[model samples]
Target: MTDAAAGARTTAPILLGVVPFGLVAGVTAVEAGMSPVQAVAMSVVVFAGASQLAAIELVGDTAPVAVIVATALVINLRFVMYSASIAPYLRRLGAPARWVSAYVLTDQAYAVSLAEFRETAPGERSRLWYYLGSALSLWVTWQVATAVGAVAGAAVPAGLSLEFAVPLTFLALLVPAVEDRHTAAVAAVSGVVGVGAAVLPFDLGIVTAGAVGVAVGVALDLRTGAFPVTGDGEPMGDGGRERETDDAAGERGGERR
Candidate 1:
């Protein structure tokens, strides 16, 4: 299958979480007295589910718009890291294409695209297509599901309690990522910290939890003398190798003298 097609196919199953999540966002937007147009517009514009839900909840509470905007931005600050992580794959795109890709970026998009990119060759065009395929599929699915919920209004079942799907979906992605002991430690600590910090206001707990997890992972990797690899798949900071090369050159010079 083509890279784009493969990305779409891989992303299909993950949308199980996204489906109900979008439905809830749409239903909540309408419940907050948003017109169906405004609701879907928020989806198209924001595209981040956690921030969208949080903003809608604030809207229902009649919170000031400034507070709503601040909350959304704070919640999405993690995207700075996500963008950095994926920059290598999408850097070859034109500015306009990068902007579009940024708008469509989501947790699921990042997860699925990263998985696909790992398998694909280092071709910029193929990588971009795969990322777009997965992200756009999510975009389309979310918009349609949200529109249905907004128009249907109370017609969508309350019994489904679709909120549960959100966590389950994240858990699905989390499992594959925790492939090693270091990662497992990070995940365990982060999960505990996140749950403990859930009492924090404005959903700062997620940010705090993420920070702690990253710190743990970084510490473990450093202790093991591991570092990030560069684009050429070379270890970024192997001072030992450089020093060894220098020593060999010096020994050769001494022998010649």
Candidate 2:
């Protein structure tokens, strides 16, 4: 099967959770007095469900614009980590493609792609198609589900409590990543911090917990000479196939001249 097809197939099962999360986002938007158009726009534009929901919460609280912005930023800070992790496979694209990729860089996309990246060491062309396929699958689902939720609004029913899908979905992605003591330590630290700081204003606790978790991971890495993935994502060693390809191209140029 084509790489894109593989990516789409890999992402298919996750949509069960995504559907409800998107629906909740849409319903939450309308319940907060957003126009269907505005809610849809945000889904298409921001495309980050956690940030969108957090922003909605702040808006409902009549919080200041600064707090809302800060909350969104805090929630999305994970993307910095995501970008750094995936840059090796994706950095070869042109500026425009990079821009498009950035927009579609959801947690689901990043998690799944990184796992695939480590295993396949797929070439750049394959990586692009695969990532786009996985990311677009999610992008389409979020938009449609949100639109439906916006239109359905209160009719979505309170008993479903669709909000639970968000955490459960994240847990699904996270479980595979914690394969060792270091990762387990990081998860433990982040969990404790997140629960303890749950009452913090503007959802700063989320970032706070993440930051602590990352720091602990880093310290452990540095101390144990685990400086990098230790195997997975060995960005230099794995994706360096592209670097080798580049050198080969330059040598061919020299011989041709």
Q: Which structure among the candidates has the greatest lDDT?
A: 2
Candidate 2, run of 10 with poorest lDDT = 227-236
Residues 1-257, model 2: lDDT tens digits? 38888888899988889999999999999999899999999888789999999998778788899988888998898888778778877766899889888989999999889888876767777898899889999999999999999999999989998989999998998899888898899999999999999999767788788789888988997888654343333354454556567778999999999
Per-residue lDDT of candidate 1, residues 148-182 (tens digit)? 88998888889988999999999988898877788
Q: What are the Cα lDDT values of the candidates?
A: 0.84, 0.86
lDDT of 1 at 142: 95
Instruction: Mark the regions of model 1 whose C-alpha exceeds 4 Å error after superposition.
Output: 231-257
TM-score, cand. 2: 0.86
